[model samples]
Target: MKYKPHEQGFSILEMLVAMSITIGLTGTLFYFFKQSQDSFVVESARTEMNQNFRAALDLMARDIQAAGAGIPMFLGPIASKDGGGTNSNPSLNPPDAILLLYGNSSFSPVTVKAQSSYPAPTSTSSTIYTDIPTTAFAPGNYILYTPAQSLMQASNLTDYAEFSLFNLPSTSAIGTVSSGGTVIGNQLTPSTFSINPSDDNTYWNHTMSFPSSTSLRVVPLDEVIEYAIDTTSSELRRNRNKAGWVTVARNIFNMQVRYQIETYDDSTATYTASWIDQVNQAATNNRALIRSVEVTLFGRTQMSGSGDRQGQRAIAQTLEVAPRNLNLPGFAPNR
Candidate 1:
């Protein structure tokens, strides 16, 4: 078969042009794929950050709701004492420390059996023997509420006395009652109510005292929860019952809290609300007036991947919670 030069399959120039077009299309596809992958990584990181923040907020909210659940009636529930320096990071900014005290929500209530002791330590006039053995009581802080007279038989509404238990000698000494006429004792010392009428007294007096056979309720000191931010580590941590702090969320940049104070106007028959920081509350000495809290949390994503995929992202979350235990009716202070 005789064929002319014009009838050849493909010239070098034409082949070169086709190859160049193919290479250009392949490069374009690779660029778009890389972009999609980078976008996916960033979006995934953002989602993870959001989820982590939400989980942390839920835990904090639950603890806040139960703050001061079984605290002694005379003691303030929320304490804004600044945990200025932590064991982990001392140079960190004085992040505000919040202490929530509640009773052993798990322990069952034990009853008082005898007024005086039975044998080993012998019964003292101030002893309150319980039906359970001394070993049954867990050695810790406790709240004791006793009524001078039963509700049905009480002529005065203020006949009940609430005592804060302190310096319990041991699990065996649970029956022993503090001195000073059943009033708030030394709190740090162990003693019985003084027989002298002139002694600084609380619930118990010469007339009104915890009577024998009276039903009493006792709850342990607290759960003692604290939330703090470690600026150095960029993390949010929680402290439980002075058991040390544990990290909750990583890459947390900040945690802020604001307290809400509520006041009731009798004449106007209305309630008023105000927001204040811990510093202002300290100046006013109205910590008891705090009714609710607003929390703002900030977090960020860790740098991940390489080159185009390597970058950090940030997120912020906020929430408001009311602690029913702290804002108990007829007990909380005015705003």
Candidate 2:
């Protein structure tokens, strides 16, 4: 072969070295490109998580502040379940759930025209005949109906009217509404009215009789909100007005709730404030003592990997909300 630079092909050693340099350069470029793509995806997922988490918390905070608005003090405003998730067996230490009740003050209490209490609170005799028309009551709306027998509670001194919550009488429960908007003479059928035992207080298991119109009160509650985590899908759920649960945010791994209350310390001869995990079986009137609510939500991105690349990394945010309508003992906010 010619040795002239223009005519001669490169020697074997030189050709080998040049090929090695080109391969090394190409491999390095590809590696950097792959790294850049992975970083972008991870960051994008985290940003999405932040948005979802913020939206979920905002909705919950608003409801927490409105917990007791337009509700009677005697009616417990807030209730919580320690383990709200599907595996939420209390012993399992699952996520938590919270329920809040409130009403629209505009909805005045309807006096009962007549009521029945037979076959127990389980049957149709549980129907409540109100002086007002059934027009105001709708599906999912609640009425606090007082029976003649269970009207007094030692815990409640002001109003001797003890009431049980029912979820019907919307005219759909039985006969249709009349021209006057009232279902005169007609009553709801059996299985129409379902009692919510956990409303303000527990209802007596025994059947009780209805009281006279003058003695009975029909209080209306417009709001019943519950927040929980759907463990199976790892999402946050919200249920409103006895409606079915709906997803609030995705990839929300866990939720926790705590009740903040003021308790009187007999030993210290003073008042103390604390946050408790469970409110159902507390020594004192925990529900009534609740001055505020504390929520902890855990959110994570939607990627899956190990170590630094793990999409399971969770970001936790905490919020404390106090309802203006909640009554506090011993201490009052300045007007």
Question: TM-score winner among the candidates?
Answer: 2
lDDT of each: 0.55, 0.60
Give the worst 10-residue stretch by lDDT in candidate 1: 150-159
Q: In model 2, which runs have C-alpha deviations exceeding 4 angstroms?
A: 1-7, 84-93, 109-140, 143-163, 168-218, 266-268, 305-311, 330-335
Q: Would you estimate the TM-scores of all the predictions?
A: 0.60, 0.68
lDDT for model 2: 0.60
Clash pairs, model 1 backbone: 117-123, 178-192, 179-191, 179-192, 179-193, 180-193, 180-194, 181-193
lDDT tens digits, residue span 197-288, model 1: 12233312212223222455455565656687878998888877556789988888777666776555556766677775452222223444
Candidate 2 clashing pairs?
84-95
RMSD of every candidate to native, in Å, equals 11.5, 7.8
Q: For model 2, how does the per-residue alpha-carbon lDDT over 83-130 read when each residue is reduced to its tens digit?
A: 544344332457887877676566655554433421123322465555
| RMSD in Å for model 2 | 7.8
Best by lDDT: 2
